[model samples]
Target: MRIIIKGGIWKNTEDEILKAAVSKYGKNQWARISSLLVRKSPKQCKARWYEWLDPSIKKTEWSKEEDEKLLHLAKLMPTQWRTIAPIVGRTPSQCLERYQKLLDEAEAKEGADLDLTGPTGGDAGPSADDVRRLRPGEIDPDPETKPARPDPVDMDEDEKEMLSEARARLANTQGKKAKRKAREKQLEEARRLASLQKRRELKAAGIELKGKKKKKGMDYNADIPFEKKPALGFYDTTEEKNRQIEPGFTNVHLHKLEGKRRSEINEEKRKKKQKTDSEGGVGFVPARASQLNKLKQAEQISKRRKLLLPAPQVGENELEEIVKIGFAGENTKAVVGETDNVSSLSDYTPSSTGLPLRTPRLIGGSLQTPRTPLSVRSLRTPTTERARLNRRSQVVKRDLPRPVHVDELTIDDLTYEGSEIEKIIDLEMIKLLKHDAIVYPVHGSKLNSQNLESIESFEEFTDELMNQAREAINAEIKITANESDLPEDWPKFEDLTGIKQCQNQLEINRNLMIKDASRAAKLEKKLNITLGGYLVCYKVSRSSALVKKTLESFEEVEQAKIELDSFQSLNLSEKVAIPKRIETLQNEVDHLVRREHELQERYATLLNQKQEIQLRIEDLFAKTNGNA
Candidate 1:
């Protein structure tokens, strides 16, 4: 078997395909983008984009300032092209290449000067471009950072297949969603025709079936699906419903009597509706279920109702008795000097003559609370749904299709009675069909919350039914997968690559966070020092509302004391007297702290690595022992 490697200088076809893939799937989906180009990996696709093909890359000739800044930054942060690239407004590869080119020019200049003084060779060595150029049969090491070569007139079969596959994938704008919608539409049309045919057949046989117009399909209690209307003219006709044409033709015939599709009938009806609507909006059209909701709304708005208050509580007799009690209390208080308790003047009932309790004021028809004597309205939403679920479940159980044997059952042994065996076979077939319905859902049916909850908690099934379902699912998957044309292991590879990239990013971010934390501490210290003098000076000069500022300054002072103490062990007198020496000492102290932090970080990393290796060794030993 011949071994084939999958990367080299990118061709024109591959480059174009890559560009199209990126536009479709985007830069983040490098695995998907690279799948179009058989020769490139995800990393290569990403590098190609960032290093050369990206629109954001500055491909123009390098300016003098850029060169100077590049050299300055390069000297300051050596071998950190990745860090310097963003600051230089370029990619890492571009920065490195430019830096090397400048160095080569300087070296050549020095060599020219040397050649002037001493004897030189007759032939000049290869130029920088030629020196780096790949020989025939030798792969280009950094092909991603180079421009794509021109494409040949004829493409290889594999390349053609890949192109076609990519084209097909991209062209399918709707994908699974479109396929689902199409299936739903077909199912709906089939259901409508089936219903119409049934009704026609019944009428033809002289059996006038009178079924109520339902708002929902199968789940009759659910809310009707309505098309939302745009805000419109006065009197609000937004509640108008779409009308359907119930075909009146008795039979299929020639000329105008020829059978028309449901869509055609609807289109004809719509044209008539438009004509009626154009005639100054005078007509009221009814839905198939019943009258238009707009008519009901208009009627409700037009009507006037009597103010019917809650059935009059505290009738004439009760009111009269209450007034008499109040008068008696006042008269008794005025006549008698005062009771033992002066506050008792308000109470006419001397514990014995307390008025009899009357029934609570009649409110809306709801059950009253026992202790509080108040009517609490029930929450109908969940209760109504629960009721519907119970109703539906009962109906489904009661009205399940009576088992009529379609296939004849014959047993050579005749171990069990024929009726008993037939009944069992029917039950198993019913269960199988139920399983199929759950697994392969119908497009026409809509499930409410009750159905969804019920689905989640299913009844027990026989092992035979489960096995049959499993086999069916597997068969379906196999048949569909043949047309998908994807490598089976590619998805696993993508997952691995994603996890690796994420881990790499986490490490980079961790380092950045550590660096930022240290820098922030330094900045915070400097900030407090800079602002500390202002607060002190202001408080000394001013009197009004200076406490707030003084407290702030005090807090800053305390922080500064802590920071300074932590900074150095030397006392004020022992510290360096000279300004430059003080500065140098601070710099040295900072350098040592930074070095310590870096060392600690490295130690932690090495510790983690050690643990990982130890675990791996244990795993290996366990596996070896198991094998033995």
Candidate 2:
């Protein structure tokens, strides 16, 4: 047989030629086989043998046992299909294809398992056994019998309805199962492709693929040193050594003596006390009688020293005469000479000529010498008078006074006539009184209706009568005054009467108003005092209430503290049980977390299935359009 290859065309003769060549040369000798087949390349011959001519190629579904064997060989020799082919009883290409299918299925199953173990998936799906158990019974009783064709007769309505329902339910369950399988297959393919891409990326980055190594168990004896076996004994001895030291060392030397020595010390202290008592209790010291008498005499002398001494006698007339002539120039020399004589003389003595001596003593004491008769000059002017005259002589002199003139008065004297006195009357007094008055009149009559109506009390009525009297007096005075004699600013009789009445009314009103104001002010002050007392009382009450409330709150707090203490004094079992409860709750929380993970996975699967269905629908639409 002969074959031709031009523009990828193949004929029945080509297949025959390839088969015949393969049969003669075997599957491996692609070059020899190609030489026998004319117009065919060795590569082409090899591809044809593996793809079509080889009887070992698995066109049927791979069984479980075959799949397991393939997986085992693939794991032992990854990507080495030629080496694994004979062991699996398949061609290299067939082995490779089966291994790849197994890998895709494994990846899909892993992806589905991963989705099932997620944070929010529902409970696990039914297993194969559960699915089988849940499968409905067969409708037909006979194993080999098919349902016969429906008779031409009409069926019972109930039977028809039941059949239809059964069909619908069966259809629904089958559709759901098919959809689940399709979704699982799609997920497997997607995860497989993703895993492949990840491996490719890792390979490109020069990272070596390796499995996680298992950790070895801990060796407890590794860290212990044989030489240090007695180190733990050191801690035990340390505690004993610490205990041997006296705990009462701090108070051991507090007392100076102890036991029999303490009694001896007490006896010595008693002896000391007895000796002190025998010696006047340690603080008594007796003074001599003579020393006491001397101290008394010294106190008496000091008291006598403070008594007033009699002043020297001098005649008032003599002292006055000295003061009068003290400032005279002629007496100045005499006064100075006397002062010198007084400074030089130490004591008064009788002179040889029978003159009395002036006694000299300290200014603070009396003279101790016997009395001598006074000299004529000394009797006339005493020592005090002489001293006064001398002191006056040392004073500075005053200038002469200026002369006074009686005719040079600055104020003028007044002369009064009987007629002028009569005219003056009380006009000045009235004007002064008017100026000092607190109330002034408005330009209106006091007898007006408004004024009358404004009088609200008896006081106001009396005020009106007084105003009328004052107005009459003012009108009489104005009427008696001549126009030429009247002041320029003075009003006429009628106007003056009206003004006086208004002033009187205003004054009365002012006094009445002032009395009311004073009363109101007194009332306001009383009210303020009452309010202040009330505020003080309120503050005191509030403070007391606050103190009471605070104490009550404190009591409550103390009670709560006591309760807390009682609660804290619980049994060891109860305390231990609390942690157990916590652990159980933690376990429950872990279980809930797993449940939530399952729910999330189920939701994700549903979402993925929805998306796949949408994609399939889109593909179907595309295919329909393409067919059209």
Candidate 3:
């Protein structure tokens, strides 16, 4: 039989029993221990021993060395607390907790130390311990501080080996340094000699070296002698004296300047013409002028050539003019000019008013008809001729039958015989005909009938049934209300306080069950009455009640927990009103401080005045004593 150790705090007897069982059965054999103990399971027994009963587990404050070791181990193996726990002589959970605490402290310290805008305005630098841990090759850049070298006597084996290697390196570097010094000396001598040669060359060439020339005196205008210097004035007249004076240059009119420039240009052209005439006109003329003269000669030659060419011959029909007479009877006649045989239109001359002379001609026995005037509407219909022409040229459109649908049958229509139709009857139709014989009346046929008495009787029956159901439901509701009513003995759940009180009562009941079971076990041992036989069942029921009460109270506890978490997580101002109020208090403090300082100064002044008065009074007393 499994003995469930329900909701009871561990007692000394239980602890002793667990310890003995653990000792006898070993730590890992929790199932055997649980069986031996009879009141705890493997999980419960293990938790009891490790959490509270274990003597090896330390619950004391962690030492500095232990903390350092834990931190180092944590850095070496992060999150593996079980590995570090043994080395630190603590449980894994304790080690993890201590490490977290240390880390938080270090972070806070770092934050406080690293204030960029604080009084120091800079970091205080690393700690002395960190500096001491620096390697030999790494040196602080501060001039006052020197890199630490390990003493041979104090050095470990590794350090000694490093020192020997460093000494060898130093020796090699010294040799290289001496060679480098010799090379540098040679280079310096070469540079000195070259610079001397360069200076000699410059001096031979009479070139002065560029550098700052020293002034005779510190005064800015020391070059000007005191006696010969002009009077000090804001504007200098030296620039005016330096300007050139041209005769009749300033006040010349713009028109006169333009006329003078034109005359000068004419004189230049006349001189050029004289020079050309003196040279017998064989001097260069512009290529464009020569080309123009040649073009004119070529044009005159082309005109002579065109005049020498014969005129084209005209046909008789083309030369003959056809003229129609309006009232004269038609008699064709050809009129020829006396000077020219063919009187062309080009040869005809118009009068001075630019009007042409109209002459009538007779045609072959017919009268000419006058042209009719065009209508405005005919001019507006621009597309009429085009549309008519298009319509005349268009092909005629004939109606073509559309293709018939594929489902439409092309076979000839024929009437079917009755015998053939009968042979082709549908299965569904036959089934329906067979079903018609056994078919019952339509649904609700009786209800649809106009029998008022029967309808009233049915409604009365439904009303009676509804009333009976309502009464039954009302009785059931009353019974349930009575059953659900809280007894006077039952605990209240109105508030967190009442719920907490109920939780406490449930805990007490659990404790009582544990006590009673223990007592019953003792009684069973003393007598053979089997008193503890029912205790298990009783304990189970009590545990269930306790669990139910705990679960019920859990909601309140959870709410409180959430509130606590929210309170803890609140920022500085929400958590407390101090920060905002502190500003006002700080202002008051500053005001008080300023007032105190002013009062101090005033008191000092008053003290000085009192001293002066006291001295006067002493002097007066002395004089009065002297007179007396």
Candidate 4:
């Protein structure tokens, strides 16, 4: 079965040849060539041989020489990285990363100089200053040139004089107090002159003006249109200017004359219109025809409807039983009474007394209940029998799906609720019991271990058999209950694809046991199979799921115990110190947040105050200038 790895024809059969070759080969040679086609599955064997070849494979040791070389080359020429990367067989980026790491290490060293004083410095050498000074009124100045403007304060005397004049002119023209005073004086003078002129004009015209007839200023013809009124069927030829009417008796007399003339003209036009309409003979015919048709239809509908009878004029107490259901016509009452005459089809007429239709009455000496259909009565027998049987079965058989550990033994024997014995059972036992029973029933204080062991074995079998029994029992129970049942949707754990996980775990546990056994037998002159260790090993073998769970539980218990011990081990002051520290931190944070809010509020208030003060100062300056 010998085979050389490279040349094909000279080798033995592929799998057999590989197995033989691996057996003969040295460990170092096997590691490098394991990927080649082999006689048998070579991964594990090849790995084992490779591990044998290099004892350091168990714990790989880093070489100081290689580490130093990488570090030196990395730091020497970091920017020109590709030049030195080939020495270490890495890319430029990798070299750069290594250089950064070396830089970090150099920084961490107590007295090491980070300034890599090498033949070539790296990219982080000297930085150019990125700031520039601005000239007056100049933005984005050229880096190579000097700025071109002098500062405003350095202006010549002429410019300063011009600026002062501009400011003075602006102050005089825009000042509010000066402008208001000037406007008030102008208005007073204009009003006095206007009143005097009006008095002079009224005296010259020999007319007395009342308060409502006082004249406005002499802008006469300011509101009239630029056209003269027509006179006697002829338009005026002259381009007349607009004229304003004076508020006096003269204007009132003129308006009254115009109104009287217009009224006379309208009366004459109306007389002509009435004469023409009488001759035309085509008015109101369309409107009257529609009105007559609507009246006729209303008359026909009224005649077809029956009139309701009027109610008897009686007091409220006299008409107690005779209910007035509705009024007929405008004021008539329609009443219904038990003895009132009404049409009846089958010797039983609906009562007019407003009682319920279904209420039985002693009519013609006969009593009858409302008839029910036959179909409804016939459908009840099977349903009621089924319900009664279900209730009886439920009374006889009442069991809930419980956890395997708790369910395996009955309440009288094992304690249904969490008693002492129930606590001892593992959680995995609970999970298993959820699938099916884990133990047979037992009695007495002396527990029967044999049957319990058998039942445990039965619990661990593939779920196909146990599920069948469960399905049958469920079907039977559903039948007894006469109710449709829900189907199980979750996968059975034993039916799941990952059971290989449990097998792998078991294999690892067996290997560990074998190794420990061998070590004990060799070291202490003790046999590999002791009763105590063997029992523990047997427990592991019996339920790998449970053993794994138990180990995790023990770890958690140990952690909890450690935490409890640490709590118990605390000194009195130390325990109290934590809460005090926390309180101090919370108070500090609260104070800081309050201070931050206060500062923000103060900043806002100060900004508003500053603006208000600026406005007030501006107003004061304005008033001072106006006075000056």
Candidate 5:
């Protein structure tokens, strides 16, 4: 990547500066260096850049003398600063600081101080043991009594080569074995992953290879026929085979069929009533059976009862029956009780029995009164229903088919425009002949149409009526009010509790105004007026209460400021001074408020006393006015 610097300097040049920062400080600290370089001067930035780059400078020239001295120091003392520093031409401290570590390897090699020459010194340089002598107070070497350590066996040329070759082979074999094991494991894992991928692919394609499903329509037999065969050796009889009728023979078929059906129905009914032989059918109880047979033979009994309607009972006191026949021979008659003698005197009597039944007897039947038929019954209606029927007939004869009256023409009756209106009016008039039908009493069960229409018409015009009612109501209220005065105990507007309350409130206001001079002045100023000195002095009992208040407030504020200053002078985390002055001021304010409340209560009590005196004065005036 190219390092591009297009802006003002390294600080503004985002790309080049970042690259330099990364190269000098490694990629890890590049961000921090770039941030610092953004604000630092270019000289400071260049110095930091040079310091980071200078330590890692590589010198490619071979220092042959330095190498020879380095190897020489690797022998001799092997780890001594004094023996290694001169050979490197550096300080003893620098030798120990930088390269004394290079001399330390000689202590690990066997025969480390032995000169590599023949038994005596041949051409090898001086051994470390023969190099120097020490002065007094320096420790001398003890040689004669020292035990000689055995020399390590030296490797020949071929053996050294073999050892080198073995080490190389071992390293190569271990590396290859590790790589081979990793490759085998990777191959095994890849094969496992491939198997899983194959399973997923098959699952995605919806293939169930392990078990195949059966196709539809293959499980059952479809060719079986459904027919019933005749029983062996069975054949149709001649009646069943040849008794078939031709078509269009409905009457013949029905007549032939009904005869057999009637016999079957009678057989079914008889079977339903059958009794066992032991349980006394006709053969077991012949005597009782003959009695029943004699009754059936001597009397002709009918299963169905004849229906007879009683004559209509109309008048209770009158004896004559009003028999009115319609033009079509439809007779309407009113009869009383069970007597038919009047009908017998008429021309409608039967010749066989000389009875006057309503209809003539049948051709072969006689008009005989059967004394004992299926049952006997009495006259069933009560006296009250009979009386009500008599009254109902009177109403019907008086009101039926009547014309309407003019007073009874409702809005619904007015729907027709011309002749129908006259018809409805005539019908209404006919309906009104009975006094009970025309006028309904207020206590009656119902009102007639005239009364209902009059009521509805009165309600329809109620707006002016309501106004008149309101005027009458006001007049009555005024008269009632003028006839009586207010009770003696009732309060007047001026003497009521509201006036007393207002006086008490004004007194409280005055007391509150005087309780604290400064507060009173503030209240007065807020109310935009000045309290006279006399009132202030009379209320607070001091001419300089305002001054005192001002001084107190100033002192409080000064004390607060001083305390704040002291608190701020101390450490920020430290506590404030104890609030002794503020507590004292708060206690004083509470006491003043309590005094204000007490004064207010006293003022209210005085105001109540004044109100009582005024009430007594008003009562005396009322008594004088009444007596006069």
Candidate 6:
């Protein structure tokens, strides 16, 4: 006996079967309906229908109002997604996903504001994206909510059997009662035939027979049961006693056995309908008997599908020259290339060109970033030859933008550079380190490994050290990883795919400083290019003081500039120093100006927020008063 997991993305056959089952069993009776499908359960069927397959579900773009309403409702009801789902006109999963996406976007924007986006380029971490996007390897919990992939051309034996069984079960028109009645009628006929045969046999031997009288129930041969007596009319009493007349079988035609063929009836109806119409029933183009008839025919044609003719063996240049010579009225010779067997193609394509006709032509791009280098624990096995057989369908992805790196962010991960949180964390780590040093003095003692063998020879020292080690082991130190310099070191990972993940960190290269400097230089050049002269000016101002006072200046131009009277002889040294002093002052002025602008902006933002909060409170109070 084998146990199999039933749920995943649905295939075309399953979808079609589900639709048929739903039609027969109705929207309710899911348990009974589920019996028709081998893989899907009752709950999954119900969810698949309601979440995606149901006609009522909206799959269009969410409007501005819907987004606003969703956000407002989310704020009011927090994690009550199921309750909010109906109001939002979305499935619970959709509502929850959308809410999470919105929150991620907001957090990303906030991180950008705090100058913590990108790797070392003021980028805090990976930006927000559809984090809930399905990855390969792992099964989708709600495949019912996604579109079904088409079934392969060659289906399994089990699938065919399930399809046939479903067809037969759904096709049965008679109910339980109808079947029982038919069975009883058959039994009665059999009994009548048996009795008739027995009588014939007895009569043939010249034996007299009497029929048994019924003690209970009606005797059909004698009289009708539960008959109502008709009231006698004065003139109709003699006629009522007369024998009833039956239709003559001699006059009945073969066609009259079943009056009016269905085709004839339909023809008459169509003729009548035509007579009634001003220009017949159909439009300019003749109407199809059913909608999508052409489409159905085309689909049938596609199932057998045509293949494009393989490329002909010919010399293209020679052919062209021959055609040109023929046009020029000169005798030309044709050169045909030798042909090879095309039965086994190395690859498949519509035309026998290198690429397929259906494949999209990729326009070459102007710029591309180099792939990031990654650190691996060890080398993996190289991939083998590509598979020629059909592969599993790719998981459906959302239309949302894909982020470069998939990062697992936490509250402690992306705080402000000089924030209180950072300061507190640093302080806590230092404290933990100190405590570890004191309590676990074994670590400090191990720094002097030369004393290890000789320590036991000194019995008094050994006893003291052993006692301290025991005390350290007994010490109940309650500390978290954040509160200690020594990390748990459980190897962080980037959740890339469902099964495979990348290490969050890269391996340290030998020329680490060189690589770092190169990347920094490239990043600086890019920033300068994108941001313009303002950043360059700011950087120049900051580094100007250092530039003016280099080691060479301390060696050569210590007092030379002041000795030559470039300006007035009076206070020449002060004059030379005045420019450098002015530059330093100018740098200070720039910083002060930037700081003042920031403070003003922050102050204004606070005032606006405060005003809005006040207004909201007043509105709430007024509403409460009105309700009371």
Best model per lDDT: 1
The best-first sequence of candidates by lDDT reads: 1, 6, 2, 3, 4, 5
Q: Estimated TM-score per prediction?
A: 0.28, 0.17, 0.17, 0.14, 0.11, 0.27
Candidate 3 wrong stretches, greater than 4 Å: 1-13, 36-39, 50-52, 111-628
Error of 2 at 409 (Å): 99
Clashes of each: 0, 17, 0, 10, 11, 5
Candidate 2 structure quality by residue, lDDT tens digits, 1-628: 6344411333344565556655544578877655544445777666666655567665655666788898887888888987887787766766765676666667659868888433434665554334434246534222111112333246556435644553443344335577899999999999989977897899899986764656487546765434555544434466666666657665666354344576888999999987876677334334444566889999999887666879969889978876665546345555666755643333233456853477677577987566555523442247655644433211111222211211221222112234655545444333222222212222331233332322331121243565697799899988796777566645565577667666756876899899999999999999998798787799789999999999999999999999888778776568889999999999999998899789779989998999999999999989998999
lDDT (10s digit) by residue, model 1, range 1-628: 8464778888877777778888777779998888777888899888888888788999876877899999999999999999999999999989999999999899879878887424346565567777877788987788888888877768788879988988887776456777899999999999999998999999999988888776445553554457487577667445555554457755646756757888999999999987876574544333421455766777887885667788877899989988998987777778877656554444423455765485454488664545553553333566555754453322254555421221222343123345876866655554444433444344443334443444455565544676797799899998787644567767877887678666756876899899999999999999999998997888666865677788999999999999899777556645656676889999999998899789779989998999999999999989998999
| Whole-model lDDT, model 5 | 0.53
lDDT per model vs. reference: 0.73, 0.59, 0.59, 0.53, 0.53, 0.67
Q: How accurate is candidate 6 locally (lDDT)?
A: 0.67
> Per-residue CA lDDT of candidate 3, range 1-628, in tens?
8444332344444565567666655799887666544445677778667755688888766866898899789889999987888899987767865776777668657868885323443565654345446576764322111212223335455435534543443344335677899899999999989987887899899986764667666564655445576578788779999998997899998978767676888999999998876576455556656877999999988887544756768766645542222112122113333435332212222246853354333486454443356421233244545653433211211223211111221222112234545534443223222222122223323222323332233221243565697799899887786544566424443555456556756876899899999999998787655656676589788989999999989989999999988878776447477777888999999998899789779989998999999999999989998999
**Candidate 2 positional error at 55, Å:** 3.6
After superposition, candidate 6 runs with Cα above 4 Å error: 120-131, 173-628
For model 4, how big is the CA root-mean-square deviation? Answer: 46.5
Clashing pairs in 4: 14-39, 15-39, 16-39, 221-243, 221-244, 310-332, 310-333, 311-333, 404-433, 404-434
For model 5 the TM-score comes to: 0.11
Ten-residue stretch with the least lDDT total in model 2: 402-411
Error of 5 at 261 (Å): 99
lDDT by residue for model 4 (320-350), tens: 5345322221123124323333221112224
Q: 2 or 5: which has the higher TM-score?
A: 2
